[model samples]
Structures are given as C-alpha cells and as structure tokens.
Target: MNLSEHYNALFKKSSELILSGNYTIDSKINDESDRRFGITLLVRPNEEIKANIQAFLKELKKTEPHQYYYPNSDIHITIMSLISCYQGFSLDKFSMSEYVDIIEKSLVDVNEIQIDFQGVTLSPSAIMLQGFPTDNSLNVLRDKLRENFKSSSLPQSIDSRYIITAAHSTIMRFQKKLENPEKLIEVIEKFRNHNFGKFTAEKIELVFNDWYQREKNTVNMCDLYLR
Candidate 1:
C-alpha cells in the first residue's frame, strides 16, 4: 500500500477500535505521561537557541535508545490535557463540543504563562524534560473543569494528584533496556541547562493523539478561545 493508503487504513482501524469500545486502556501506575494538549503559552526562542536545543535533543535520542523519545513538536508549556475519552465511557460529538466551551470558561483570566525545560531525566518508561515553576494556574483550570463537568465527561482521568495534572513533556522514550542508569543521567546532566525562551500563555487546544497509528499520532488540535 502507498503511504497515504497505509495511514488511512490505520486511522480507520483505530477509529473502529474506539467506537467498538476496545481501545480504552488505562495508564499503568508507573507509566509517566508525556503527551498533553491545552492552552499553552509557548516561549519562542531565538534561532540560535532553538537550533542549539534541538541539536541537544537529537544527540540524546541517539545515545539513549532505551528511552522512548519521540520527535519534538512545537515547544510549549501545557495548561491541561483536555480529557478526551475514558475506559467504559464514550464521548459523544456534541458533549465534546460543549465541554470544550466549558473548559474555556474555566480559564478566562489566565493570560500570562512561564515555563522552561531545565534538563532531561530517565523515567522507568521514558526520558522527560524536567520542567519548572509548578504554579496554581494549571491546577486551578483542572479543578474547575472537574467541578463544572461530570467525571465521565472529560477526556482523561481527573483524579486529584494525577500525574497528568502535573505538566511535563516526555522528550524521548527508551525503546530498549539501558545497560547503565548512571550513564543515562550523566548524559541528561550535560544538556540539563538547555532552555527555550518564554511565551505568553493565551489559548488552549483540544489535543488528541492517534497512538495506534504510526506517523499520524497528532489526531486533532482544537483551539480553545479565551475571553
């Protein structure tokens, strides 16, 4: 099959699985989440800084084959993962649209946002950029979404203290076993100082991923307007 046909088939199969209620898998206790979508104010860096940071990530991916690292998407700090679907429950089209509005109303005043990826580290499942300045801004929006919407209506698990509630991006996933833990962190420490300049926090997006399909992971990006 051609590339387009191949992806189309995969997307078809994935949607079928979801509609059939067979793909609603829960994250394991130890699985660290790297995927997030929301109103993120991405700090745009200068060309030199952006190039330098990207080069660092490229080297990390090469040296650390054991960690699951995906290619870098647009760099931005996350506000929240608009809970898309959960096990045992299906999100209807209208409900999804309404809740998007609800989520928007919840975070009307959050105009300014600050973020930085200080360095990298190896989690048991993947390598992540250690981020900073965990303020109430992200959490407040999360709590309000839960309060305004029923538990089953949101896209992801909304339990208090849930790791997704903490915003951090997984830069790489170790595909193979690491021979030495010390070596992994040692490499991480080298680029630990890499930083992307700050951007104003303005909008949120309903980000979804088609994890079942290769190359089509970014399923949809729905923009959430702020007042």
Candidate 2:
C-alpha cells in the first residue's frame, strides 16, 4: 500500500465506523477528529526541520515496519481542518466576502508564535510528536472565526471551553487491528527528547480543504491582511 492508499483506508475505516452506528457524529466531533479540525495556519518547516522529519520517519520504519508505508506529506503543523459539515454548508462568494470583512476588522495581532516538538508521546491510539503551545496567532484567528460566524448568522458548532489545543500534523495513523502497543510505547519514549526547533507564524490561511467536494480556495486566515 502507498500513501494515498493509507489515507483512503483510514477514511474508509472511519466512515465505516460511522455507518455502523458505532460512532455518532455530534458536536462532540473533536474527540473523533483528533487530526481533522479545520484550516489552521501551520509554521512551514525550514530545510533543517524537513530533513529531521524525513530522518525521523526513516527511524520509525526501522523500529516498526508495516505493510503500508506513510507518505511524508511534508506538512509541519495543521492550522485547522474543515469541519465535516463544511461540505454541506454552502457559502457563496458574497457571504464569504462579508464574513471575511468581519474577520479582518476584529482580528488581533501577535508578535510571534513558536512550538518545539520535543520527544515523542503516545496518545490514546497513535504516536505523536508532543510539544507545548506558544502560538497565539492561530488561536486569535480561531477566535475571530467564532465571532465572525456568530455576527454573520452562520451556525457554528459551539466551542465554549476555549481549550488550548496543540497543533501538529499527523505523520501516520494505524487501524485498531494494526496497532502495536508495546513497540509504539517504546518508540515514543525513545524520541521523547527529540528536538524540533521553533518556527515563526507569519500568516494564517483559510484553506478550503474540502476533500469530499474536491474544491479549495486560500484566504488569509487573518482579516487584517485581506486584500
């Protein structure tokens, strides 16, 4: 299996789980979408960090080989993922333009944001590069988004807790049957001290990653920078 195959399989598995009535798609969707949240502005990796992730993946392969290999997408972090309902939630250019205006006018400014991926850690299921949050730019954008939707009469999933979520792009994911609990724990612990250097958050993009609809449009995640 290749990279696309791996992603397709994971999508299929998740869809199947939902279809089987085992999982309910409710406002509590975050618990299920650990990886897919919405369009988030991620700090692009410099050459050094890119090489490090490549080397890291290589080490991962040697530590625990699998039938399917993960394709290194080269994305360092996720800004946000489009909501699953975003496919059904149609927004015309006019409406989107108005929303953009609101976002632009109410946005906040941040000097810099940084997060260092140190070591590895195991979530409930998958292995992850653990790090602390230092980026307020993206968070400000997310907040602006909520305010934008509220004032524009656009229905949004309520997220009142204002949880400080960590931002990292998933390098790979495994199905339940394919999980190797012991090896995963071992690998995560070994790389717990892995040093991924800091990168700046210059701008955020409202990327239209509508995988289901097969459409994308990039808008500055900040309204202040809108052209």
Candidate 3:
C-alpha cells in the first residue's frame, strides 16, 4: 500500500486495539538490580511548544481524567535501546561513559534535527504525538548510532519490540480500562489532524530506567551533542 494507505491502516488497527483493551504496557523483565537504558533524541520543547502541548493535554484530561499523562520533563523520541542489565550486564562491562563516547563520536558530523508535530496517533498502550522531521537529519543520525552500537560490546535490547523505526513522542497512557471507550475514541479522532508544534532535537541522551517505580520513568545519564 501507499504511504497514506499504510498509515490509515495502522491508525485503524491501533484505534481498534485501544478500544478493545488489548495492548500491553511498555515494560521489561528484570530483577531488583537490573537497569534499562535507552539511546534517544532528547526533545526539549521551547516554551511556546510546551504551552501548546500542555493545553492540549489539559483538554484531554477533562474527558479521560483517569488516564496517565507523561510529565513535561520526560518527553523524548527514542532512537534505540542500548543495554539492559536484566540479561546479564554490569556497569563495569558497559559503562555509561562508554555509551556517551560512542554516541559523541558517531554524531560528530551530524546536525540538529527539526521535527514538526503534525498530528496525534494511537498505539496499543500509549497515545503518541506523531512527529515528522523537516529533513532526513534525524534518520541519518539514527543510522550512524546504530552503526556504532554494532561494533560495541553493549548488549542489544532484550525486548524485541523496542526498536525505534518511527519518530513519536508518547503523551499519555491508559491507566485502567476506560468505561466509555467510544467517547474517548471520538475525542482522540478530533485531534488526529491537529498541529501540536515543532522543536529542534539537539542531543542524544543515555537514559537510565527506574523500573521499580510505578511510572517507570527514565533518568538522564548523559548527553551527546550534535555538531
């Protein structure tokens, strides 16, 4: 199918899944000592963009009051997962310093990526703001980082579905089964074509995950700036 057809199909399938309550939460299997780290494009939206998205989120909360929203501080677009201590790993073998060095070297010649938040889309577990880069700069950076990881001793993501093939910022997640799924779907459809805002992604961060918490938020370990 063509691009439009492909997205339409994906949206429809995702919508159905959201309404059916058949999606899984973003999580991994790990012991108490394990930590998860993701290599991602840290999107620090400007004040204007932040205000616009916050307003939209406030509106969403009016209808879906029970849903879980991501904090403004945690917004980012993942490029790929680097390591998971769950599957036999230690900081000594794959240090955060090493990850930063790899990302910095790989992105030495890369430039900042301009991304436009054009619309909202639904996936099984989260509501995402779909992003389109103004150019292929983000893709080029991702490719370069992937190449760096290929030659490193860092272990691949334990979760097979955690690959970053698309650029999206997850805005909200379902905390419980919605009592009125159709109504929620209607509200989301209204914003399917809404323009959220735009921002430049300047750095890739090595983020550490605290999975023991209820929200499972990530902590910024280090940043690699693009030239």
Best by lDDT: 3
Q: Tens digits of per-residue lDDT for model 1 on 146-180?
A: 66655445444444334353344555544544555
Name the candidate that leads on TM-score: 3
| Model 1 TM-score (2 dp) | 0.61
Over 105-210, each residue of candidate 3 has an lDDT whose tens digit, in order, gives: 7777678878788777777777877777777776787777778878777665523555455667777777666667777778778888788888886666666554
Off by over 4 Å in 3: 1-7, 20-41, 84-93, 211-217
lDDT of each: 0.46, 0.46, 0.66
Q: lDDT by residue for model 2 over 104-217, one digit each (tens)?
A: 554545445566655554333344455445545556765666666666664344353333255554554444233344454455456656786665555444443322211232
Candidate 1, superposed: residue stretches over 4 Å from native = 1-53, 65-67, 74-78, 82-94, 151-156, 160-165, 211-215
Q: How far in Å is the alpha carbon of 60 misplaced in model 3?
A: 1.7
Instruction: Judging by TM-score, tell me the better candidate of 2 and 3.
Output: 3
TM-score of each: 0.61, 0.60, 0.80
